[model samples]
Target: MNRAINCHVGCRCSHLTIEVSHGSYRNFTQRFVKAVVNTYKDLIEWPKNEHRVAEIKNGFMYGEGRNAWGLPAVGALDGKNFVIESETVHAEDWRDCKGNFSMKLMAVCDDKSKFTYISAGNSGRSHDAAAFNLSEIATVAMENHGEYFPLDGYILADSAYPLSHYIIVPYPASEVLGRSGGASAKKKFNKIHSSTRKAVERAFGILVSGRRFVSKHIYIKDTGDIVGIIIAYYILHNLCIEMNDPVLEEDNDETSNVDVARPDSFIQSVNSTAYQNGRIRRHSINPYFPSQQ
Candidate 1:
């Protein structure tokens, strides 16, 4: 096999047995990715059926060979940044907080680390919450929560996302510590949330570490191409999961844990009715998890 093509497919090719031009390789990869994405896009859809929903919920509760968190969640939500070449139109918009020119990929994954929902091509500068709020899933979730998140179930998200009827966020660490000054019900809940939410992070790790095209800085100038390539890899990731491919050891350690900065205030405060409802729901479940010493 050609060395460049072999390496591009995530197999370590040590020797250059055949020379392949960069342009030719890139064009080939683009065509290959487009074909894969178009043929298998349905593999990365949100769970809608009762059986699938129950399976995802069970996966979350007993994931990583651990006990159930007892929370009704179908998926874990998170965002990731994919580095890209800086020479593009509106390049400044892609500059993230860490000074990398990249694009944001928001996703929700099941307990088995398979991507169930994905929204790519957002500016890296956009907050995770903002990116999610603009996603089709969020729009549909807001319009009819039961249609997506049935039986009052919600997605488990980190603090970067806002709490809503369809999404549940962990209690802010600062607020949790300040309220009790030590271990408490909220603190225990955060621990469980983090444990369960790590599934989404692991899903991203599998994508980045398994695909050489995604792990390296993409040199594409067009944002559309970049988005397509990323989404194609996500589709491939789901296919790999379906095949029960063994996850690489390094993938577990490749999880990204960037801290998000929150906004000072909201323009429409009344919209917080949902936030308050989320808080109430969280509090209602707090008693179920007794704090331990």
Candidate 2:
């Protein structure tokens, strides 16, 4: 792969490829190096976040994991883990709570299962909301991009995220349903929500499956760079899906429930909760497409 990229740059084909030397990778082309470095500087340094923010502006609608915004859509947020040899005593202890105490990557995904925004590693023990609350996605979205996708609405999530005007979380405990509010909420869910918000699962599955990212053989001085490489893999994965590529393999980690998301239970609780709450109601405003609707 390195040889291909290197040779592509070296031979100077009309195909126009750019490379960026980051972390351990170097020796692409001068154009590639400068382009990638500038891109990296923009994303991580320049304005503190130009790459992902610009990506969202170009096509990565923050809340819509679908074709674009204003369509049937929902973004899914979840954390991904990578086990490298531990970091510093302080940082190591932070991630170390996970038995392996390895580094973790948290990200928000579009419905198509592409990363819309990613957060750098927090301790493996950090909660989803804690990581989310500190993220730059919302702040960046709020920047000047006229007529942009509304950062003003809700997105479906597993019970892990907090329910708010901009986010929807499943019933905390299904048992709480069967009461008046519970039954009503379940009815609303039937009308406007579903358990098949499956993009996050598919994304993680592809990462661990195709990239084979679950093993541990990495030596680490800076595991964050390794995390970036994994994310780059996902970008290529999404690009493959976008390019309509039919060549890909299923994730072999069928038994690896590292995410611990229970979509079945989540949906079941929505229904059960409505049964307990009151009467079911229809969605006044749908978030899906006409076909999906």
Predicted candidate 1 versus true structure: per-residue lDDT over 1-293, tens digit per residue: 22354344422232234444555666787798789988999999888888888888877776566665645588888888888878556778889999999899999888788888889988889988789889987777667777787766788887778776677777764545555643467777777777788888877776767666667577567788888878888898899889988876447556556433243244125257777787777666554344323
Residue-wise C-alpha lDDT for candidate 2, range 1-293, written one tens digit per residue: 43333243433432335433332233333344355434543222111244433443333233444433422333555665666665666754655555766655666666456666566666666766566656664455324323223432334555554443344554434423475754554444433343334556667776666654343433434655555555455556656666767645446553224223334454445446432321111232333324224
Misplaced by over 4 Å in model 2 are 1-71, 138-148, 151-153, 174-176, 179-194, 214-217, 247-293
Q: Deviation in angstroms for 290 in model 1?
A: 6.9
What is residue 104's positional error in candidate 2, in angstroms?
A: 2.4
User: Each candidate's lDDT (Cα)?
Assistant: 0.74, 0.47
Best by lDDT: 1
lDDT score at residue 263, model 1, on the 0-100 scale:
38
RMSDs, each prediction?
A: 4.2, 10.4
